[model samples]
Target: MMTFAVYLIVFSSVGFGSMNINSHYFNKHMEKLLVSRTFGLAGIRNIEDFWIFAEGPMLDSLFPEPGEMDGNIIVGGPRLRQAKVQNNSCEVHSHLKYLQDSCYGHYTISTEDREAFGPGTTSPWVFSHTGSDYYRGLVATYGGGGYHLELPSNKIDALQAIQALRQNNWLTRGTRAVFVDVVVYSVNVDQLLIAKLLVEFPPTGDALPSWFFEVSRTSLFSKSKDYYIFVCAMISMTFNVYFLLLEACRLVYLKLTYFSRFWNYFDLSVSIGSIISLRFGIKNYLFIASTLDKLPDGVDIPSFEILARNGFNVKVTTSIALSLCWLKIFYFLRVGSSTLAKIRVSVWSCVLNSLGFFMVFVLLVFAFTHLAHHVLGPHLHEYSTLGATTTSLLRALLWDFDLEELQRSRPVFGPMILLVYLSLVLTVLWSIPLAIFARSHTDVMSEISRRCNLWDQWKEMVWGQYSYRQGKVTSEEELRLLLEQEGLTDEDMAAVLSRMGVRRGQHVDSHHLRNALGCLQDAEMLPEVAVRWLTDLKQRVDAAGQKMVALTDKVHMTLEVASGDGS
Candidate 1:
């Protein structure tokens, strides 16, 4: 129990630390860079907007100067790549003077080697005006049209390439879309971040089109792997090993029946998933580092996508394993608590009883979904598709639908259909499952109560037998004090103790007192008629004792007063 508690605490701490680092440091900075009005995708209206965005917030935020000499802040300059289909007929025209004059061909420009293009360069591959290096090769079209440019990390050189593209009217030509991919690696913080912005131009008008931006980040130390992480990992491994061995022993002893219990299955899954998740988490950290190392001069920019996908897998697996681990708490709780056991039983019973009703409910929902789609598909966008209609119907079931919109869509059928659906679902269908659950819960509570009462009765029977066989003893003085507190006079205490053969300073046996009292009652030694008489006698004796004590106190006070007068 202690080990499981420590594991949960450590796991929660690690999860919290990871969330803090990702949300506070990485996500906050990325949001500022991507959502800024001045430089964000939303503000790009003309070709000049691209220049302002690239040179302004993008540079300042993404390509910030290194704080230390050894700081590893590697930046992959944003590349505006336009994908185009390759043409076999363009093979011969590829050597044309102008790339635009020739048929579209696959090629990428290198901004580093300016010497590839000399003065008066007319090669279709080279951008002579910009002095940029051009390499003729196959480029991924990605089902798009236009030329692609790979800009250098140098801000001025990149700007020059952007200017070259602008001067050549590349953006205004047959360009359907331009993709900007940027990668930044902050090794000091072990963070690899990637941002992609897509700019799509309008099909007819010259007006600027909309842009979509996305950012994904993965970190190695987001969970902060300190000494405690190692310690917890070791503890977790030890526990898994111990449980596996214990389960194996149980399986051997109990044979196949051991697997019949649901908790055993839960234990095995949690153990296996935990080990696998831990292994993957470690590999994910190394994979991020390796991917970051290749991003500096790496020709394949899509590697960042692979890194992000792997990081996401690690997170998902870890989450599942952690969730299973936490759920095991319920299994443990039900063992010591009858109420929890009853709750578990009730839930199981409810599920079993409601299975048929659940299927019917699902069928009804789908029927209504189809009806809504057929009726309101043309009039309302919410019911335009089967999936959308289903979602809207479910929302309506939860009282979240726009009643006014529904009424406006089809005045005659809309309100009528909605009324029928709600009436049937809420008034009839919903109540069936509730009634089943309530019945199951009541049955479980009554059954558990009956078992608890039986167990209590058995315990009491055994305790009664044991106490009769071995009677308890109490000191005579203690017994006398107890009787006095119970309003019994001193004479009555002495008589009872003497009748039981217990003298002063001696012990009184409960068996002897019981036997003597039984005998006295049977012989009518202390009669029922004398019970009120004895009670009245005891009350009178107590009153007399109080009066005598008061008189003694008065006598002492009078003596003191007389002494004072004499003096």
Candidate 2:
């Protein structure tokens, strides 16, 4: 049950389900924000012109049933509530007021929308300065005829013109003043709704702001609901604390020798990593939150924002520690079942004992991989680099088996060469390691069986010595002799006696036998083997005791018969 609980904790620590929930919640609104920000048709001097430029043929696809252009903005909101628009001849002033009153319709401009006249150009005969010949022709034609017109071109050319107009700020006053409105949004349904302070750019210019941009709520520390994040942090800290306490108790009571194990040091390191990760995470979050509170509109805080979004140093360290923690679950297999224990022991023994075979396998792979690269490098791009060649060969060995690529690269000899390479890899690299593992498995199993059998025999010897001693003390020599008589040789009896710390010629009693059994049981010796061996040993001891008793009785009866004859 304790092992099961540990497994459950390890699985739960991944927290992938919660992460998925967070992603789904944010993705819905993020898509809307991306659409509104990237393709939002606001602040364009000519909606039709910008649409033609941005979307090309896709313009019709976007607005199939064109009723009116989308200009979703409110002028007299929080930021513009205190501003007054100065009189200006620019058509944009009229457009702003039009939006405030009607709040609908597309924006358009007349042909005489010139900011300056060339020195040589006549009145109503506008001259082009920093514009294309196309623009100059349009200006001359419009100035001569006094007719309002929109440019006609394909999507590609129109988009280029629109880009030029935006860079020049053709719609603003004098192209000198800039205005911006920053709206902080919290997600509502599938769209962003304004939740906090509205900030306008050019704090000293005309109190009216030009356009707006949306930012996520997490940018503002006060608005971000990071309570769930904090809760997760607390859970991680609690888990680490539990780990430290357990490790400390083991070190204190299970002997200081417990700390010598690699796993104990590993657990300590992960616990330390968890603590440091949480510490830095909280510190960085609070720092970002404070920075967000001080940020002004139209100002960027890229570093802090990215840190909050992706968790900076905290994510790396926490992930490292968490991955290590999950791997620790395999340690429990050492105690779970006999098969599990055998598997763990077998794998380690196989890998360590077969290092020479593994080295040879690597040598073969490297050698043939370079040979293939030399032959196929010019034809096959995957063989262009040594790393790429190694990867391709390794993949083929694993049965990814894309020999067709080689055939395509080299039409005549590729198939034959590939067959030879595959044979070498299959026979030398794959078969050799597999055979080593199989042999090592048999050897390890035999060793485990031999150890268990010795444990059973040792327990039987201890029981036999205690019974034959007849509740009195007996030397180790007597016990060794008795066990030797029972088929255990001097060497075998000495090995068992040494394990039990029974010095030669040292006295042993029943108490010693009971203590030896306790130790063997604690060491996880097979219980059924010990029980069966002890049952048979007790029967043998009884038979020996009865024979001794019968011999003594016969000697007494003979003495009595001799005394009666003398009388």
Whose TM-score is greatest here?
1
lDDT of 1 by residue, 375-483 (tens): 9998886897798898888888888888798888888899888888888877657689779888999987777565445444433542353365444336777667655
Measured by lDDT, the strongest candidate is 1
Per-residue CA lDDT of candidate 2, range 119-211, in tens? Answer: 333321232321111111100111112111122223344345435544543333212121111222333322222211111212122221122
Q: How high is the CA lDDT of each candidate model?
A: 0.60, 0.50
Query: What total of clashing residue pairs does each candidate reach?
Result: 0, 0
> Which residue runs of candidate 1 sit more than 4 Å off their true CA positions?
35-74, 80-149, 154-179, 185-190, 197-227, 241-255, 295-300, 375-384, 395-430, 448-567
- Candidates' RMSD to native: 22.0, 20.7
lDDT of 2: 0.50
TM-score for each candidate, following the candidate numbering: 0.56, 0.47
